[model samples]
Target: MIRFALILTSLLGLGITCQAADKQDLSLLTRTAEQFARRQLADSDAKITARKLDPNLSLPACDSLEAYLPPNGRLSGRSTVGVRCARDGWSINVTLDIQLFSQAVVASRAIRAGEVIQATDVQLQRVEIGQLPSPPLGSIDQALGKTPVVGIGQGIPLRADMLRAPAVIQPGQSVRILVNGDGFQVSGEGKALGQAALGQSVSIRTNNGQVVTGVVTGVGQVTVTP
Candidate 1:
């Protein structure tokens, strides 16, 4: 009877040891998943957060852990990190909540549609990028000289979709048409057939009664390519 009791005690001790080792393995796996997530996410300034695994969740011990992102996984917002132990045929996924803060352009005052953006009309501010309805303009250089497609209220975040290059040439305006070939550069006067922004294509009616198409290269210049 004494020998049997001793054997039972030893078995119980062994079970406890196994349980502790399993917990350590799981902890290592979780840490690995977190590291993988940090590397895959785009925001260098992002703050990462994740919930602790349930204490009662039971998983078999794994020889190794491989962390990966699932298909169609995004780095922003709510995301999941998958950790697998192929040797043990067991896997778990960790869900993470991420937030990124970055500089964004905001309207200093109400802006009307078709109005050109001015340097003083916008300001840079640090905002939670993850919560933006759309990606906001990150620099003042991007906002300057762009015309708004719609009116924006004061303090509103400025998005790239809302603005465009302001027209530099209007219909019936006189423009210089520059024609260039392998070794020849020539210039002529023409009438713009339509409004065009810098770098946009414009149709021109030359003084010689010839209609030509060219790209608007400057405020009053069009470059014709053959």
Candidate 2:
């Protein structure tokens, strides 16, 4: 009976020892994985710049992320940490959410994307929006012409005498010019007459045997040079 008890105790001790060894091995593997991930995502040198996020409006949302990390980093397995934008010699407040994936793996090392990506995890890219430059203001003392310059600011009315035909006008072209009056005639040379469309300009021989220029306001009605 004493011999049997000793054998039983010895077996138990061996089983416990094996289990402990297995646990230790697993722990080592986990640590190694964590380190590998960090090495892959470590960014050493990075360059960032400012850009316009969207056109038609000036807002703080356009920025880019320039990061340089190790060649072996898997982005797909990680999560995005943060995004930063560099401006005015410092990083600005901007945020972006982007995801990355692992491209290749060799010798327990993973490569993600092309290069310079920090991690396979999702990251926020920061940006900043700036105001666009204003257009040059026109001179107030300049004479008000018949042709109304339609722009951002207010303007004048359509004068009849100020209307004149444009040179080198083509069909399907729309032109804006001042006519001397509401009634006008459109006539052009052989080729120009047939090709001219409404709102286009063409030269015409007037009834008084004078060569005049005018705009084609209608099918036959052209505003001539007064």
Candidate 3:
């Protein structure tokens, strides 16, 4: 009976040892996945959660595990990191949750649509770039002289597609027209017949009532080339 009890105790010790080894292996796998995520993300701040393998789950023993991102895998949001044995002996998908943050331009106060964005209208703020539908503007001055397509509330991040340059010439406004020829340049005043943004075409009626078309070059300015 004494001999049998000693054998049972020995077996229990071996079982615990095996469990500890398995746990360590799993921990190494998680750490590998996290390092892979950090390198791929390259963001200032990120929260990466690696898959949790069941302690009792049956898995093939792999001495060399490698982590990789699947083809076209997203860097953030819901995604997965694949871990496989270096010899293709076993593979598993380690799911991940990654959140990336960035600093971008945001409105400092309520901005009305069609109002030119001034220096005081925007400010830099932290935002989750991953969650946004489009990339936000990089700086506050990027929005200067631009008008929003729609009114934005205070603290809303600004996107490049959200703002447009205001019209440089308004209807019936006085404009300076520069006519360019091969060797001659002439400047005259005209009444703009329509509104136009910079680089757009507009019609102007000169002082002599002659109508001419030119490209809007700057505020209250247009240019016609021979």
- The TM-scores, one per candidate, come to 0.81, 0.21, 0.74
Cα deviation of 2, candidate 1, in Å: 11
Best by TM-score: 1
Instruction: Please write out the lDDT profile of model 2 over residues 10-48, one tens digit for every residue.
Output: 999999886655332222222333343345546512122
All candidates' lDDT scores?
0.86, 0.34, 0.86
Q: Is candidate 1 or candidate 3 better by TM-score?
A: 1
Q: Model 1: clashing residue pairs?
A: none
List CA RMSD, all candidates: 3.1, 24.2, 4.2
Worst 10 residues of 3 by lDDT: 20-29
lDDT of 3 by residue, 1-226 (tens): 9999999999999998887565436766777788889898764578888768677656655778888988888868877888888864677777777877788999999999999898899999987777788999987778999999999899999997888878989999999999999999999999999989888899999999999999999999999986
Please write out the lDDT profile of model 1 over residues 1-226, one tens digit for every residue: 9999999999999999978776645567667777887887654678777757777777777767888888998656777888888787678888878787788999999999989888999999887788777889999999999989999999888998898898889999999999999999999999999998988899999999999999989998999998
Q: Is candidate 2 or candidate 3 better by lDDT?
A: 3
User: Which residue pairs of candidate 3 clash?
Assistant: none
Better of 2 and 3 by TM-score: 3
TM accuracy, model 2? 0.21
Clash counts per candidate, in order, are 0, 22, 0
